[model samples]
Target: MIRAAKCSFCGGDVEPGTGIMFVKRDGTVLHFCSSKCRRSMLELKRKPVKVKWARKTREQAEAKVRRR
Candidate 1:
């Protein structure tokens, strides 16, 4: 079953079979919708919340849902 992936850095939808999947030495799996997302995450080491252009992360969205 193909499932849509969420961008690890931008919280954007990554269509099945598209985007980049990065695996860290510690077994951390990160999905990036675009090279821009990948660069922001690994190279730049920027936080989604701290970046004004970044979208709200899945955790942030879930937190809002749980709070209500």
Candidate 2:
């Protein structure tokens, strides 16, 4: 049975139209409808994301101490 695929980037239904598949080390797979989306997805994986709690500054730490 042939199942329809979906695009990870734009959430569009993929119709076997020359798409690219990405596989991670943990066996996770992501499919993209075009090369453009695939390239962008790879770039996103290369960048590091900062945690919200880790973004606190020195002043914020001092204020928390004063409140306590």
Using lDDT as the measure, which candidate wins?
1
lDDT of 1 by residue, 1-68 (tens): 89998988888899998999999999999999999989998999888977766677556766899999
**Each model's number of backbone clashes?**
0, 0
lDDT string for model 2 (6-33, tens) is: 7655545667655777888999888777
Number of the top candidate by TM-score? 1
Q: Number of clashes in model 1?
A: 0
> Candidate 1: where are CA atoms >4 Å away?
57-68
* Candidate 1 to truth, TM: 0.79
Model 2 regions lying over 4 Å from their true place = 44-68
Residue pairs with backbone overlap in model 2: none
For each candidate, give its TM-score against the true structure.
Answer: 0.79, 0.55
